[model samples]
Target: MASNVQVLADSWIHLLLNLLGYGTIIIPGYFLIKYIKNSQYIERAGNGIFSRIILTCVYGNTYDKIVEDTIQAQKPRKERSSFSDCSQLIFCFLGLQVSYLTWGVLQEKIMTEEYTDLSGSIARFKDSQFLVFVNRILAFLLAGTYLMVTRQSRHKAPLYKYSYCSFSNIMSSWCQYEALKYVSFPTQVLAKASKIIPTMIMGKIVSGKKYEYYEYLTAVLISMGMTLFLLTSSETHKQSAAATTVSGVIILIGYMAFDSFTSNWQGELFTQYKMSSVQMMCGVNLFSCLFTSVSLLQQGTYFTSIEFMFRYPRFFWDCIILSICSASGQLFIYYTISCFGPVVFVIIMTIRQGLAILLSCIIYMHPLTLTQVVGVLVVFGAIFLRIYCSHRIKQINARRAAGIDSAKV
Candidate 1:
């Protein structure tokens, strides 16, 4: 048995497996994007309760299904809307709270564990301990189960849908998970701002969407806000010493880029494939699980310590909670991006960031400065600016159509 195991664990074999895993994380994005462009629903809803083996079946007539019908007629789309399904909003709120809290809390744990960012995160994966092994298993199980259940209840087979949207969703998640292992919570928020650039570029290329002058101005303002916050609030600033904050900032930037890619790609998906948020999410998570599991195996032989949760129940419990939090936050983030445009969604996220920052100040009591306050305000302003630009553009298009109608008349 041991010799057979060794045979299977050849470096070449393991390398192939690992690459496949990493590929799983991003490759599906192509399909996801294709789904977006196809302009229709591909996945179905799961049985109200999710199962590990099932793939959520998307409504058959997804392309033909009216958006308002899903939002109004049956299975709940977003609970937050004032529509009849508003009650689902309560769970949705709890879901959002759990998601943010988990991201914030796990982020703190990562720091306590002395991780700096994704580039460095691979190191932690190298150190094999029973507890972390258990964590890998649990994370895989929880996240994977959710993915499968979501898929069974929500999606069609890979054969039926566009691959670009699915793949983009997978890449977006892969980057975020990898980043979470490295950066600080607040820095992550700052990093989230980076998505704007990618969104703009993708929008122009894929969606044929042109940016207005104000949009460019808003991007500049967003950059300035980030710089001010970095300069004013960095630990180096407080100590009056030069130091490297580069790692922290880089992790966030990575997160921001992938996140914006997720959103910007959505517009293309909507224009091209017309997939629902849930459908895309199902694809992303399914791919994420496959890759995460493969990555865990390559990190070390995990089966030996799989039962550690039984030995250190407390640690196991903590990790479980953390994983749950992580999962919830991820779900909320994806949902938010899908429901609200990326700009509006991030604007809502800033609320969570502000709360986290305030608590960080109270807990560690980090020194607050006027510049820091201004920085936060600047982010908010940029978010509002994006929303305004989007709204105004919509109105202009509406009027353009009305004018065309008059011309035809």
Candidate 2:
């Protein structure tokens, strides 16, 4: 027993060392970016650093003024959409859909199977926490660079708040990847349809927000739809590896809770700090990179994942594509929310989810039962009802404010 305890302690020490090494990388990378941002020689020479080249390619100029203008293109306008605006909107919508679909398929493919024999035509592909780490790190680096170039790095909130949000964000990411290993993409999407329920519950619990009767009814419909869908999927699970599992459902539930809490926390922080969407994205992703790095290091997954990737170039490219798609989707999501309101964003996402389910079923040849069809319809109905109810509430508030203004006059 003493020897066993000693061995366990030694393992923990090794894990600690690994985590420290990852920290060394993150800290130096962050400082290097900051140093590059402040460098006078790069500004005078206009061609000294790689960051300048990237900024020039992305923004047509390496100067701060030009980068600022290019970043402004991301901002959503409240005015009428021009022809250029419409064209850009279409491009963004398509990009968002394609990126989301690609990542979903790639993740499912990577985790679905492992080759048992060397004679297999394709190499083994497995999910790695290190892949998650790399994804976060790459995204963070890109976002941080944008902030630096655009002079937005000065708008960060407290590191502690970002750290807390990062923990939740990484947890959501981890749960999602793990859940995908056990659940079909369509089933997982269906389960996630009830995300509004958790958001509502958390709002009430954490912020004391009140909801209307119709909203509660809509939540109930969503819950019923998800339950019905699950019930109808039992036979599918028996035949399909991607079918829903209890473990997957549980993990999804945890994901919903964590995601809801994190979103609300972010809202609270934004309100308190008066930060922009760009700053929120940068800060959350930056800290998320730190958290995931520590996790992959302590788990010692980076070495194994890297080794496997070297052997299977396809898997390596798949992981990279997954990360790129995810980042692209995020940018489009932010652009959409900024251009349109949250309601419009919700509608677009609802449509996207429907298409994803349809495409997944067609591509994977998964059977959808009549009960599931009805359930999906019910869920969609609930979503529309929520949208209508929200509009009604807004109208009521508008009329009340008008009445008060008239009374004051």
Candidate 3:
């Protein structure tokens, strides 16, 4: 009876701590949303203590600036010639392939390989949060620099709004790194490729968006492919049964959930704000760095990670290059979408995902069964089918629009 009571007490303590952690993120977001919704109340409240507190803490004297910027209409972009567009499309495709492929290899290497510690003993760097901080900080710096160098529309979105997506982004990235400890890199890559299912689900839940029948069909195909891939894994791989453990599967699920939410939230922000991609990147990474640094500091691992980096020079260089690749990858994604449209960008990314898996297998000597190969082909084939169907739908819509315009004329 006493032991049972102790266990119950510990469970309550754990639950409470989790709630507290969530509240730290949620409570602030609640107020920010409230402020955005009730800006008139803020203006009318007029120097009251509560109003002043909200304004000072949340808006920080940028209320007028944000209002002005938000109300200003964005100018439409000029159309580019076909040759220049093709050139940019090729550049972005290559940049994304190189940056993300290198990033993937370094990521797997850093997570799976052992390095020398300060005491000259081999140790693996288990601090996933620290790696997240490194990636975000560098990306934040790069985004900010890009914004400074180029002429961008004045950022009008509430800076606090970025915290919501940043929280999810950090969680997703942390899960990605953590899952690598349990799952093979190829398994993780395949799982990531199958994100359309979760993304569709998140779209419905978050935005009440509806997907077409073919979207569901493609999602099911991807699921089947993922199941076949995981179920037919060879026993000789280094990860073996451990790769498909419940813990790893759960981490991957968390990764997909957070990643889906991050993308959906980003889309919503893009619709609501006229800021450039670099501005969005800058804002999100700024909050990401803040949140991750605080968490690392609280866990007392911030300085420890730094010391580990100093001890292992190779690891230091690996981290630096990893960060650079990540930042550059984001730029490539934006550039690709801007130049070639999302259909082409999706096609390029789908190809990159396939190459990333193949590269990981070759470099790591991960043996694949014939069944697994079939699964991979099935997954990619479904993705391409979905992409083709989407293109058809767009073309159909364009024809309909042109017909309506011609009839009105």
Indicate which candidate wins on TM-score: 3
Q: Which structure among the candidates has the greatest lDDT?
A: 3
lDDT of each: 0.52, 0.63, 0.72
Q: On residues 1-409, what C-alpha lDDT tens digit does candidate 2 reach at each position?
A: 6864574465446446645655675566566546655774344555557655434322322244445546766888565434555577677668778878887777777777553334456656554556676677667777777777785433424444565666676667656655665566666656565566676677677556677899778777876776566555543344336656576677678677777776556656654444566666666777777666666666677677777776666676777888887777766665564554333344455456556655667778878889878888887798778767766787798799999999999
Q: Which stretches of candidate 2 lie over 4 Å from their true place?
A: 1-97, 113-123, 151-156, 176-193, 226-253, 332-354, 360-369
lDDT of 3 by residue, 49-125 (tens): 87765564455446655665556546555755545755776788789899988887898899899998666789889
lDDT of 1 by residue, 215-293 (tens): 7777767756765665555453332232224543453455555566666665554444445544554455544455555
Ranked candidates (TM-score, high to low): 3, 2, 1
Positional deviation of residue 409's Cα in model 2 after best superposition, in angstroms: 1.6
| Per-candidate TM-score against the hidden true structure | 0.58, 0.64, 0.73
Winner by TM-score between candidate 3 and candidate 2: 3
